[model samples]
Target chain A: MSLELIKDILLATVPLLVIFPSLFAFTTWMERKALARIQNRIGPNKIGIPCTRIGLFGLGQPAADGIKMIFKEDIVPRGADKLFHLLAPILALIPAMLILCFLPLEFPWGKFMSGQVQAFLLDSAVIFFFAISGLATLAIFMAGWASRNKYSLLGGMRAVAQMVSYEIPLVLSAVVVVMMAGSLNAKEIADVQTGFNWFVLTPWGLAAFIVFFVAALAETNRSPFDLPEAESEIIAGYFTEYSGFKFALFFLGEYIAMFAISGLAVTLFLGAGDGPFLAVAPWLSVVWFIAKIFGLIAVMIWLRGTLPRLRVDQLMAFAWKFLLPLSIFNILLAGMSHHVTVAYPGTTAQVVTWTVSLVGMYVMAKGLDKISRSTAKPREYLYAE
Target chain B: MSILGGGIFKGMAVTLRNFVGSYFSKERFITTNEYSWRPESELPQSIGDYPKEEGEQLSDTTTVNHYSRNFPMLLHDTGEPMDTIRCVACQICERECPPQCIYIEKSTEKKENADGKPQFYPAKFDIDVSVCMSCQICVEVCPFDAIVMNSQFELSTPDRFGGLLVRRDDLLKSNDYYHKIHPQEAATRDERMAADKAAKEAKKKAAAEKAKAAAEAKAAAAEAANESKEDTE
Candidate 1:
């Protein structure tokens, strides 16, 4: 690429770098508040209230927590491999930050120019987004391996296993979208999705959306699938040896990952940055995009609150046994359907694709319902012996 | 394929329903003043309430709003007022208390009972209510059933120690008071007591029969020895 292109790329990155972190922080607050509601408990309602009420139900809880984390004592384990310990959090954080570089916040600012590309959007973004997001697993594995704790090692191993297992389904799910959209660029995907024909309404798009959503949850290491940081089992997993601002970096990375995944979901399924009367008021799409993201985050919080976590084996089985095959099938079907649709416009092949997808979805859903029913055991009350 | 999207929509529809349902299910929503409004007497005693009773139902109405009210409400079981708890100066509660809030002084009563035996009563039974975890361990382990968890959980105080320190007079309750809070369990325990008494009576009858048999055998042996001696003479 020319120097001007390089300059354009750099300029484009600055806004995303700033905006992405802020989005992560926003999600952190939203997750807490939403989960609190789901769990039937009041979240932080204390800190920023007018007067310093002793137990004024801390409204500024997140702010207080953030402040506390900032001033927390940074601890480096005496026995840990010092270099790895130092590198782990940075490794964990960098990839999450970098993934935002390709995430399309909106369609190219106003009619994509030839040389000087806009700041907020990307031209060929989808491939770039997936590739970078896929790299987060590397950062996670490094953090886990570097920690030098047995728990950290196990967590790292699980992180790697989980990431690797889910990555297939995650990518395959996206591949279906790519097949239909016929481009690796996210902006084009978004552009197509604008108006009533949102991808979530399409056959491959719906499947891709579902798989992608589940995969996003797995990738972010959020609840139910958070075997890595399972407080009960591994005790904060990869970050067990980390503390203070270093730990904060890992913390921020997680939230940013959530933000990125939410954004990606918006782009792929919900019609990224597309709003009512977007032809008239294009800026309204940003609100729609954020709303979609927040909605996903709310679901994440709901899952966290309502569901008990999955076992490591259960999580792996979910990825490999269920998600992987389905995603692969979805990808194959999408490609075939797309090819056939292109070869013969309005043919029986398209109808076949539609019918097969419907039947397949019904079967999968029924199977899941059965699995869930059989697997779910009621919690027994313990009368103290 | 449209039907496939139907499943996704169905899922979203359920989520939407949940989103609406959540608004109605504000019962789970956490509030700072969740339990503040309910009176101490109204507050439901959980498992670990000091001075335990069987089958106590703690009220949900006693949110934090009731807790913030600036008054000490005397705890009651139903309508009858229970100003004190049945904690004997046994110090068992004090020693076994996890938080070490209870303090007791065992003293012998100089005044004799109808049997002319000294009565044991606690001179000072003080529970530093501020320190009490309300874990109810004292109620669980109390041998005499002297101490039980009370339903009065509202113990918020401005002075951590002053008003919160429950004196012996503050914690005492009658057996009738316990029964009122948990009548069914009390009745069941009463049934157990009757069964135990009946069992003791049956054991006594069996023991008497064995004693009489042993006495008759001894007498027969003595008679035989006497008769043999007479024949020898």
Candidate 2:
């Protein structure tokens, strides 16, 4: 029984450990190349296949970077809390790696197991995912406090504030999906979003998805919401004191978190693994699922290249004033639409709900924008004219 | 009415156009290619296979436009660069140089210029390129129309102090090279110089004719006076 348990554990974890990190490496290269292209410059076209004249468009760059990062000198400040400082990157990396298992990605290899197996199949998987992911904030705070640097501490503080503020809307927006799906199980959530019944197609679903995506961007410390590690304001935020492999760990953790969040977004909406030709080929579902995640990642990259980082005030205002209330309103709309659909169960109900929610969300969004704008007073300097 | 998040979408569209157009329209999107390597032509496939010789690398890589200017070089008309050199060791350019990078030592003896005028030449001309600001003041203040900006910018070398101080022999470049590098500016300068020379020659010829006419009239008057004296006698 213990052997079987060990076998099950290996089956569940080994693939995730192998797949996601490699994906992280590839994503780094892709982000660099894509950003370079957007800026009208060629990036990293020097390093190619080793010991050969043929250039594979600098594909070997990430490997070279990894090797360099590994061999770099690891420095620890004399005044730093050596234990916590060392513990911080591992802490940051754990939750991100841990959360990847919660994604309902079924593999063809699962057939070899005696029964279907997942890493952690809790009844409240979505809640568990959120609960674990929140630990990343503690890691950030620990890293900041342990670093003994003002900028690192400030970054940690900013990260905590931003992540805490944005988490509300992120969870609230996912609530729309949980409400509609009638289950907290990630597998069930994904299963419910089959065929053309994607939650994003509905009005409340669309509103919640937008809110959720924006909140996710903030949660991941992505640009336009990247105040925690604002290079101009704070030197690399919580990881200011980190170097070498520890720094690489933090970097890996951040990108993996991005993947995990984007994965969650795909499962929540976009009909996870629901694409054409699934009947003839069952394995295509995995491809569809990963493809959807990539689609969201591509959008994130595009947005990162397009938008500038928001100021602290602007970031706070956006989360509290705009996304929070909008998501709350969406929950109400979603509940109403759900009941109406159940009672009538026809084209009429869907049509009415779609129109009312669309118009209602638009008006609410505009009203929120006006209210926020009206209330914002110009900064009053104490000493300056 | 203006849409709320429309600005973001517009910005995204602009970036998307740039990202896509970079692959198709090299001239319009990819501006750095002109400064860097070209994949199709002389660029080696691998970094390890890059040209080893400095001259080969520079010749293969550096392609500055005609308008691009660097440090000043002395222009000579033809034949030996030192013999036909236009610089007369004039201190005007040296004085006018903002950074005082140009150093000139006038030759004790004089040489005949292209115009057959005895003029002092720069015996030990040197320019510290490291100190040069490339302000073109030296080119502007050169009364002989000798110093003009060179387009060769790949001047990096390991021997710092000695390498950067360009000597007279290295500074002297033929007028044909000047024309090749900057055809328009050289042509315009040549035309202006030619016009000035023609005007000077014309003025000189006119003065000679006037002097001859004065001398002939004086002789005629003398003869006439002599004849009158003889008639009186």
Candidate 3:
């Protein structure tokens, strides 16, 4: 890479680093506000200047929270392994930040010239992004083990188990997209999704997209799957020993993962950088991209508010028994379809087979729903006066 | 099945609708009790000022001027009239009251009144109504059942000190009022009283039989002693 290429990388990477932190902060506010409404209570409404008599929307709450978190005495447990304890949060945060560097914000920087050399840099670039994000599990495990708390240890163990289990499905889902676009690179994948027919329109693409989205939710340690925090039991999980800005880093890491995953979802499943047609501005694609990602983030928040965390056993079972098999099946089917299409060229049998398989999948799913309903025991209630 | 996308489409559609709906209005999306929207007329009397039109409507039901009688006046439920509560000046309720809200003064009358007996009536019975927690412990432990919680929860006051303090007559309500406030509890208590009455009658009958047997045995012993004395003579 030339100096101009390096400068372009910096330009892209630095702005993201700055942009993502603020995005994390705003997402946190959205989650809190949404949760408050769900649980039928006011949340964080006491902060900010009163509009003479009323606080008026509590606009300054996030600022107040940030200040409070900063001032909190940074606590380090006496029994904790001091080096790993200090290292855990940073470990957890870095890979999440690294993910931002690889996320295909746009196709790429077009062209760069350094001194005597001239070259075309990818409007879309490298395939290493997914592999780097996979390393976030190590940080999580390190945080869990280093804390010297049993809850932390259990949480760490669950984190490893969940990440490792779901990672297969997560990767397999990505494989469908990779196979379709014939590129390991995210930007290339986004490039394949331009104009009218985004890759998400394809059968394999749709299946992979849903699987990837669900896997991302689990990957981020978000609610409905946030057994790691298990407030009722674990008391804030792996970050139990962390406080102040160090704690904020873990907080930042979670939100950034949320942003990165949603960005990935939009790119893969939805039209990556496409917006509604308008003659006025082509740049609205960026706005559309941001909106779609934010929309995904809001659903995560909604899930957090509405659903209880799945039991550890239930989560593991779902991953291994259901997601793993389906993901494998999806991968094999996508690979076979691609291979046959290449070999036969114009055979109509491939489309017929695909259609039949889809029909079979729908029937099986409906049957399962029926079985689930029939087997579900009515909730017993005590009507004591 | 292909059209439905294996139920995944259905699932996605539900969540997509939910996602879109969450943005527009959370209240519309949310299914929850609307306690705040309940009309004031339907609402139970609150801690603050009772809504005026409802209060006036309530006031029209009964005309009780016992408040102006000065010596601890209590309102009847109907508000049409005031009935003097038959308090025998037993300060047991006052002493047992947890909040120390209830107060009583008792002085014996030298002259016997209409009941042909002289005891004492509460000269000044006062209960600081605002301080009462409405726990009804005073009502529960009262041997006389003289004090009771009323359905008239509209005990709002402008002044915390003077206006809120309910005097003896103010706190007092009729027996019928207690029956209205806690009908089921009163009915249960009455059932228990009848049972107790039946148990007492059976116990009395058994006692009388035992006494008669003991008397006959004693008489036989006396006759035997007299016979022995006559034989010795």
Best by lDDT: 2
TM-score of each: 0.65, 0.71, 0.60
DockQ of each: 0.15, 0.41, 0.05
Cα displacement (angstroms), candidate 2, residue A213, comes to 0.7
Give the poorly placed runs of model 1, Cα more than 4 Å off: A1-10, A49-61, A107-127, A339-344, A347-352, A364-385, B1-233
How would the candidate models be sorted by TM-score, starting from the highest? 2, 1, 3
lDDT of 3 by residue, A22-59 (tens): 77777777777767655544555666673554564676
C-alpha positional error of residue A341 in candidate 2 after TM-score superposition, expressed in Å:
2.4
Write down the RMSD of all candidates, one decimal each: 9.9, 11.7, 13.1
The candidate scoring highest on DockQ is 2
Cα error, residue A245 of model 3, in Å, equals: 1.5
Candidate 1 lDDT tens digits, A291-328: 88888888887667655688777788778777877788
- Higher TM-score: candidate 2 or 3? 2
lDDT comparison, 1 vs 3, better candidate: 1
**Candidates sorted on lDDT, descending:** 2, 1, 3
Clashing pairs in 2: none
User: What lDDT score is found at residue A156 in candidate 2?
Assistant: 94
| TM-score, structure 1 vs. true | 0.65
- What is each predicted model's overall lDDT from 0 to 1? 0.68, 0.87, 0.66
